[model samples]
Each structure stands twice: as structure tokens, then as C-alpha cells.
Target: MPDQAPVRSSALPVSDWQQALDTVLQTPVKARPYSAQIMRQSPTAFLFLIDQSGSMDERTTYRGRVLSKAAAVAQIVNQTLLELALRCQKGDEVRHYYDIALIGYGGLNDEQAVSLWSGAAVGKFFLTPAELAGATLRVDEVTVERNIRGRAVTVTEKRPVWLNAVHNYRTPMKSAICLAESLVGQWLATQQGNDVYPPTVINITDGVATDATADELLACCDRLKALRSMDGNVLLMNIHVSDERGNSILFPARADDLGTDQYARLLYDMSSEMPTPYHADIASLFGLDQRTSYVGMCSNADMDALVKFMNIGTPTQHNHSFTANLSSEP
Candidate 1:
């Protein structure tokens, strides 16, 4: 036989995900892709899917100090949440304006992510406030240690803060995406019940697909679109981080900045634009401008990525969509 192009793996375990897509497409599933309830009324939900793969521990030294990748990420995440909280529009608290969830992927499997606010071991849906401030969460730290007392403790001090967030679990990046899709789908359905925009999901990854998944990503996103057609607010952004430099690589756009990687940029874009001076430094440290609103994306991450995702709904004015990648080059 003549040589042929190699087949691209069907990002999912074949028909299992496809079956879900078929069912979703056929049945007018409610726009609650985030919560599993009905939200035909809210404006949107904000979600973060991060890559905690071993590679996240990228090493760098400053002032005779060694920083692991995960630790760097923790700082960014801390800031992200604080900005998110501080910048939320007037009268908007954590309960409304957003139902944020964080999912981390890299080290464990099935034991994926848990909500920092509610501390819920998640398979479906996001975490609650009580769950977000678990034993593992702290808004700020003063020291940096990967092996704290020989234990894996990264965030020694926090420049940013922690919101009820999620962490990466296992080593699969694509599985996290699957979860993101399901969550976003559920949130959108519910938001519609409350007359909302459905949520925006952002994902970040350093490695390629560990499990088969992605076909469902597009299909799932398409399903999210089905909820509102043109006026809908649901958006999904993915960022692929390379073992590149420290700065963010830009995904330039004419009216907006859009990138290709999908994971890292999502974080940069989703942050709140209007923050109190308390969060303004952190927000400004990231690419966020006081003029723009953002949807989310994946990121190569820094102190900036986390700030953006947590504050997705902070500003009263809604944000549009944004980039996905690592480093500041975008």
C-alpha cells in the first residue's frame, strides 16, 4: 500500500465521549454545564484547569534561592484569586458573579482536583467556599520550600492570595479538559435558567495528551455555543506551555490579544480589569489592562495567571475572550 498520513488519535477513548456528545446534541440539555443545575439567569461562571505535571517544577534560582515550577505556580494562583475577589464589581461577592473551580492535573489520577473553598474531592462540578480554604490553602506565604520538612510544600509565602481553588491531580492533561468541558457545559445550562452567559473555562498544560481527549473538547465547546448562539457568554481557551523562557508569549489580536497554546493564555485573559489598589499591583503585574474585560484561557503561568482566573467576574462590565500559551511572548 502507498504511504499514508498517520491517523490522529481520537482525543477521547473513542465512542464513549462521542456518545456523550451525541446525547448532548440531541437532547436540549439545560445550560448548566458548570453546576449540574439550571442557570438560565446568571452572567457566567469562571473555571481554571491547570497543569501540575512533573515538568511544572521548572527550576530557577534567585538570590541563592531555588524555585520549583509548582511553587511559581502557587504564587501566581494566590495573586489570581485575590485579584478576582477584589476586582469583582460592587456588591458582588464570591457567591454570585462567579462560581469558580480549579482543577489540577499532573501527579495523581482519579484523585484529580479538589475545591480549595469547599474542599470537595471532585469528579463532577466545582468546590464550595468552605471547601476552598482547606488545610492545603493559604493566601500568602513567606518562605519557599518544595520539601517542607521533607514534605512537598511549595508555597512558603504568598504575594498573591488563595481563593477556593482546585489543584491538578494525576498526570493526565486531557482528562482535565474533559472535566472542564463537562463542568462548563453544566454551568452554561444552569446560567441560562437564570438568564446568564454560561461560564468560561481555561486550561493550561506543559505536556501533550496523556490520555485520549480533545475531540470532545471541540464538541463540548460547540455544545456550549448551542446555549446562546451569538449573544452567549460561554468561552473556552486552552494554552500549551513549552519549557521556554520566563516571559509570556503573546497571541496578538487586532482588537484583542488571542493566542494558540490554549492553557496559559486563558489565565491571563480571564482576570478582572477593575481591582482595588490592594489588587491593582498584582493585576497590573499580569497583562490585564484597566480598560479590558477577559474570558479565560490556559497558561504557562506565573504570579499573573492565577490572579486573572479567580477574578473573572470581578469587574461589573463583562470581559471578552483571550489567549492561551506560556511565557510573556504572546
Candidate 2:
């Protein structure tokens, strides 16, 4: 039998340790804008962190269909994944244009955020378009009545469900941010000089964190968004699902619009400011006036607005025409 060679360990020489430390500490971080073109040359990451606490059981209306917050969020995530997969498909092949992750927090007793994908998708950090298309366990059919123009129409849709609707204990938002931070750091390390689009994180939650303070949660989110690639710093978006029947607020320029709600203000402060492209897109879609600066935070968003928010975050930069052709697809 051949004997294996012994492993050797090496450390920086005492003579050069000080110089090495000085060089490392003196390095500066450069900030960039989120205007990179997302293409094969610059793949991107889209991460979703969902809160599945007891509050998710609150009922809300989405596009005239009434469902729980958990179910609505699950449906939105699945639909976005399907759209992304379809966007990257050409003649039965899926391009590696983006890496995606969906995480859920607040359901398990451990209070840790975990991958929401089930069956063959467990423990997977990143999935390509093809993998995401094949990652779902089952499909559900849903019917809804919608007013199209001046007439009422019945719409039937096929939806995938990788993660089930779960409503358990309190929310652990900090843990979810920690999980995302690790993933973003790993992703950024892989794209040191590739000019890759920075990772985008979309978090859906209903209430405040139970295990961590608001400041702690914000710090974690700040750390996550601080991760960057050559293109830009990471973008963190927040969607606050509310059971209140009051008017829903979309992207706002200031926390003053959120009133005295501390939770909403915290989320507003934690969110990334939406780039100018988003304002243009939003204006085109809804004919709303453009704001000078919009933060990626929404308070009491309903189903229609939620879907629009997802579309904005999961943009297909080069394939913008794909959805226009499949607008009537079930």
C-alpha cells in the first residue's frame, strides 16, 4: 500500500505579517450604482426571504382573490420563479442568466431561516432557471374573477408550490437576514471581477421580529445589502403584508408617508433606494407620477401591487418582451 504524504501548514512570516495586515486594512471599498445590464456576461442573484409566522394567517385580497398572507406570498414567489424560468428558456434550453434562492423563517421552533424548497431542492443555495423549473413538488389550479376593461372575466391559473403555507410562532427576521448575508457574501466572492449584477433580496413579512430587536434586524439587513459585485451593492426590498383593509401604499420617497408606525419606518430605512429605471417602469405600468427617489419598501400592499413589485425586482433586462407575449398565458 502507498503511504499518503503528511499535510503541511504555513503561516505568514513574522517579518511580513505587519506589512500584510497594513495592506489589508488600508484597502478601500468602492460603491457602484445598480445600472448594470443583466445578461449572460453578468449573471445576477435573486433571493427571497419570507416570514411564515402566525400573522401570515391574516386574510387579504389579491386581484379579487381572497387568501391568507402566507398563501399569497407563496403564490407570488412561485409565479415569479416560473416567469424567470420562462424568460431564460429558448428552444428547450434554459440559460444560466440568474441564480435564485427562496428562504422561509419563523415557522420552525429553532427560529432559524431555512431554504423553502422541498423534495429535491432541500439545502440548495442557488438554482438555475432549469433547476428552478424542475424544483417544485406539485401544482395547484386557482380560479379568480377579474374585471378586464369593462367586462368581468374568469381567470384560471396553474401555480406551483415548493413551500407550503406555514403560520407558527413569532418572526425571526434577523436570522433570515443573516442567512441572506451569508449567501450574498459567497456569491460576491465568486464574482470578484466579472462585472456581475449585485444580488437582490426581496423580503415579505407581516410583523416585527420576535427574537431580535429592530436595530439588530436593520444591522443584519445593512450588512446583507453592503455585499457587492463589480456592478453595484446588493439591493434589499421589503414587502409588508397587512391585514388592514385600508389603502395600500406602494413605493414612497419618505418614511413620513408611513405615519407613526415604527415597524414600517424600520423597514423603510432598511430598504434600498430604487434605481431610476424602477420609477420609469412603474410609471409605464401604472401611469403614476414618478418620484425623485423611491425606497424599495411597501406598507400594506395588496395582491395587484405585490405582483407588480415582484415583476420589478425579478426583471429580465434583455427579455422584457417575453411577458408581453405571454400576458394571457394560464
Q: Please report the candidate that would top lDDT against the real structure.
A: 2
- Considering every candidate listed, which one attains the maximal TM-score? 2
Cα error, candidate 2, residue 176 (Å): 0.4
Candidate 2 minimal-lDDT segment of 10 residues = 1-10
lDDT by residue for model 2 (1-330), tens: 111111111133533443443332243444545555666656788898889998899888776678988888877777788878878877777777788988778776437777766656555767777787566878889887899999999999787776677788888888888888876666655554565667889998888888788888888988777666655568899988876788666777888888887777888888998766567776655456777878888887776777877877776534343223222221
Task: Name the lDDT value of residue 161 in candidate 2.
Answer: 70
Candidates in order, TM-scores: namely 0.52, 0.81
RMSD (Cα, Å) for all candidates, in order, is 12.7, 8.3
Candidate 1 per-residue C-alpha lDDT over 1-330 given as tens digits, one digit per residue, 9 for 90 to 100 = 111111212244544544544543454434432232212123345677677766666663323456755665555555555544443324433333346676666544433433322223323245433234342333445676687577888665454344222234445654565566565555433333243434556655555555544454344444443433122335555554444565554322221354354533333433222212213333444554443333333334433444443443223213311211001211
What TM-score does candidate 2 get on C-alpha atoms? 0.81
